[model samples]
Target chain A: MGDEFCSCDILHENLIEIVKKKMPQEEKLYDLAELFKVFGDTTRVKIISALFEAELCVCDIAVLLGMSQSAISHQLRVLRQARLVKHRKEGKVVFYSLDDEHIKTIFNQGLEHILEPRGFEHAVF
Target chain B: MGDEFCSCDILHENLIEIVKKKMPQEEKLYDLAELFKVFGDTTRVKIISALFEAELCVCDIAVLLGMSQSAISHQLRVLRQARLVKHRKEGKVVFYSLDDEHIKTIFNQGLEHILEPRGFEHAVF
Candidate 1:
């Protein structure tokens, strides 16, 4: 989208102009990449999946996932720092859950695609 | 769910039961992570964002992103491998676009969370 004088034009100019105007800025792209990076781990995804159904404390997550408490806590801290999960204190215990609808939406939508992709399933393979 | 008798119980048993029931299997979790890892790169995220707006060929993408054609092709290959994008040939030229609605949904939803977080934005810092 730099200018009208660049050489490549595989798409319609109007469409290219529109896309250039709407495309995310570099910083936003970086943040977006960073956000996905948090989700790009098996342990973290599992944690988010577990929290999708209900809130759970660190100990509970460890037990459910069959991981050590310290390891679970480390991943939770990453999720917490990324604002993917929220925690509330109940006495000495802190429980965690999906931060908001966005996490669930991302998880559920991605899953929907993985499990059921109308016609594109063939292209994926 | 592993069993009915694990020690930690910060949440209701019924809720734990449900999350365990719904949680993705290990293979799916690994796949999910792999899918996201592809998104975790800034150049790749920018590529997807550009595609989100309109389909374009490698030369156009390289020009638009101020990157080399080889670099753009490399990321396009990665995106192709992850099934995040699709391509078609028109004689000597090939074009690419977001594979399906899943990518669009994932990108839009994540953007929404980042731009407007219903008062939870503060926790992200």
Candidate 2:
């Protein structure tokens, strides 16, 4: 039944089963894709990366990026909808930071790999 | 000179310097975005997620995802160009896996944070 994949040097049955257990259907794939897409934007990534160290209000972010307050606010809205970032209100100012630590770890790990070179062998496909 | 950003409460001067050290110009932000764009695909993400576990040949990966070898190959190509995945040729078979341990660590940390909830607080911004 799944011979085509086997013949083409793709994945085998065991791998299919394993992937299915986690993703179930292709929709889950889309879901995952959308999540990554959020990080694919420069403005968003900048905001996220900045938040990695300290929480900042819109004004601070704007000053940091040399952008306008409106521009920063708009990007913040998109990030909030994606659940990638969250906001807190203090006095008349609002500060934004990562929604979850999952995101922080992901960014940190990626940066770590980019900065460090080791353990990544040119073995396996 | 940077009064606006300070007024908005977004980021501070120090963050701008740090981010600038890595990204330099806005163009670097675009380059980074393009890199993340590869992971923005479900097929690619699944492929990456799978590679995180075991190094599977194309056929094995196809079977695992119940996808066509052609589809898997195409996605693999994208990953390869992005330096996200690398291939190894052994006789008539080729295996593919992540190009860096940084990617693996990123994924692992993301999963860790998603699966476990701790150390993340609703403080600061």
- Report lDDT per candidate: 0.80, 0.70
Which stretch of 10 consecutive residues in model 2 chain B shows the poorest summed lDDT?
B115-124
Each model's TM-score for chain A is 0.77, 0.70
Question: Taking the tens digit of each residue's C-alpha lDDT, what string does model 2 give over B1-125?
Answer: 44453543332556656645654346655666676777777788888978877777888777777688789899999888767888899887898977876666655554444344323442225
> Which residue pairs in candidate 1 collide?
none
lDDT of 1 by residue, B9-116 (tens): 644566667778888798888888888888889999998999887789887787778787778889999998778888999876789988867888888877877676
TM-score of each: 0.82, 0.68
Q: Relative to the unseen true structure, what is the C-alpha lDDT of residue A124 in candidate 2, on a scale of 0 to 100? A: 38
TM-score of chain A of 1: 0.77
